[model samples]
Target: MGQVSDRRRIVISGCSSGGKSTLLDELTRRGFRTVEEPGRNIVREALATGSDALPWVNPEAFVRKAIEYASESLEAVRELNEPVFFDRSSIDALAHFERLSIRTPSDLKMLGEACLYASPVFFAPPWHALYEQDDERPLPFNEAVREYDWLRLAYPKRGYAIIDLPRVSVAARADFMLRTLGLPLSKAP
Candidate 1:
């Protein structure tokens, strides 16, 4: 295991609509620096530009662009003095490749292995009632479930501890995550 710094690279990851974004917003509101998910940004940009760099259209191109974004996201925090939260990590690209049954590029495989997040990665399991589709996330409930399973296996394979987030109110989830990381819980304003 790599040495963990006090400035943890915490990744909030899981299937779509599982409240990862909600918790990230809460953490950011509480003053922790955060990096948003690049997949949606990439998707929106690709669609806007009429590019074929979508997961379904061109999985390799999609992963390549995602990996690039993820790298930049990581680099953005390289000099940070406080713990930073990431909505997703580079390993997610590999998981997507797995979920899509797409061939994982050797370079992407290496990137996933090289870039690491702190252990006890927060995982938002599929919540059926809360699940909804959007333009960026069109994955159905069943596919989300499968993606969750793949994540459960993928993160651990990369030597991360999968911390399954409870299905609770977003505020409560934020508290739970802070508690899990031994950080003080935030008081309401």
Candidate 2:
């Protein structure tokens, strides 16, 4: 296990509509610098460009975008002078594929380990309250549950502590995480 550091990274992940984004927002409010969810940004861009018309046909394209964006996000966050929070990481892409039964790529396997090896990590549990559907969020409840389960399994195997965000409010969750990581809170605004 690694001791906390200014450069340590915390990765938040869960089912499609879970409070991962919510928690990340709170993390920012509390003091941690962060990386936005590349998947979300990619999906938004894809929807704008109609690149998602054939998700089944070119899922790899999405994966590649996630990987590319994750790399950029990590680089940006690494420039911060404090621990960084990620809405999610490239590892989540693996979990996404596992939920859909797609084969995991060898490079992603390496990237997951590399990122995990470089920082302390966090993951959120799926929260149904935050879940709703859109063209970009089409997984069924059962599938989302399976994706959550698979993600829980996948992350720990790579050395992340799945932060149970089931009961805490977004602010409290962020406070608890900073306390848990021993990262000092920023001065009051």
Candidate 3:
């Protein structure tokens, strides 16, 4: 188990375009602190700056940037006392390295373990109906599903419990997450 202070730092991760962002938006709308997905932000920045740190262009560089971004995010929120939901973490970036058959650096593995998140990480399962391709997420549906499969295994291997989010409306999902965390839904504005 992680330090007590870290318990409220929850992580929400899974397949791309699997409603994770929508659920995070709903949580944010309801007044919870939320962290954006590192990968997407990295992609956007890379596209804007013409950096080589893009998943399709240079996966290794992209994952490294993700790891850095996630670490910074964790540090930035360390002082927050309320529940903080993260779209993904360094673990997800490490998992991407594994997916690419790249040798996982010891430092990266240690960083993933060092930056602890609350257990029972909520994973949004692959939702075919909700999945879509956009400028940031260009993976085909099948590839996204494969990524989800990889994530399902990754979280558990890292000693974090996995809870699959139900394929329901974003509001319902937010309620479920709060309920699971033993947080009061009535607190929502």
Candidate 4:
């Protein structure tokens, strides 16, 4: 099949401070339409407004906002005629169900199960070398690793392939995703 014919939705996920944003930037730069992480934007706004400080303090609220954003993000992708990249899809949010000890609603689980996606995600591990934090985020390194594990397994039972992404320069990792997705290259950032 041609690259376009082989097209499927791609989701790049990892822990909270994982390189999801970095990967999203790469994919968009490579000429593929991409859906940015609305959850991050929401959390940033919340923190900026001082509505939510600690991710642990009001995880339920934060997760709810993220779920709403993810639904919108996925709908936009599903409506597209071209392959799209999602920085952190709702499945990642579902993982948070475990990460935060919250139970996922049946409808949300169904949404994740129904969405069409690409094989072999580009997942960024929790890198102590690269992981840092700002005020709104305070997840420790071990917690991030635990989240990473949850992500790596949850999709496979649903038939999506996993592509483990190692820590590398942003340029190289982007190049890897483009090649794996059978997409042409564009500017690398």
Give the clash count for each candidate: 0, 0, 0, 1
**Candidate RMSDs in order:** 3.6, 3.7, 3.1, 3.2
Clashing pairs in 3: none
lDDT of 4 by residue, 1-189 (tens): 644443477888876677778777766767778888766677678877887623566765666667677776767666566678888776676667766677777766666555556777667777787887766556678877887888888767557778877688888888887777766677334
Q: Say which candidate scores most in lDDT.
A: 3
Over 4 Å off, model 4:
1-7, 50-55, 187-189
Summing lDDT over every window of 10 consecutive residues in candidate 4, give the lowest-scoring window.
Answer: 1-10
Better of 1 and 2 by TM-score: 1
- State the C-alpha lDDT per candidate: 0.84, 0.69, 0.87, 0.71
lDDT of 3 by residue, 1-189 (tens): 865543388999988998998888888888888998989889999999999999988988898888888888889988877789999988899999898899977877777667888899999988899889987888999999999999899989979999989998889999999999988763446
**Candidate 1 segments whose C-alpha is farther than 4 A from its true place:** 1-5, 187-189
Top candidate when judged by TM-score against the true structure = 3
**Model 1 lDDT tens row, 1-114:** 976657689998988788888889999888778899888888899899999988778888888888888888888888875678899888888888987788888987777667
Candidate 2, residues 49-79: lDDT per residue as tens digits? 8886334447777876777677777766666
Error of 4 at 186 (Å): 2.7
lDDT of candidate 3 vs native? 0.87
- Which of the two, 1 or 3, has more lDDT? 3
Clashing pairs in 2: none
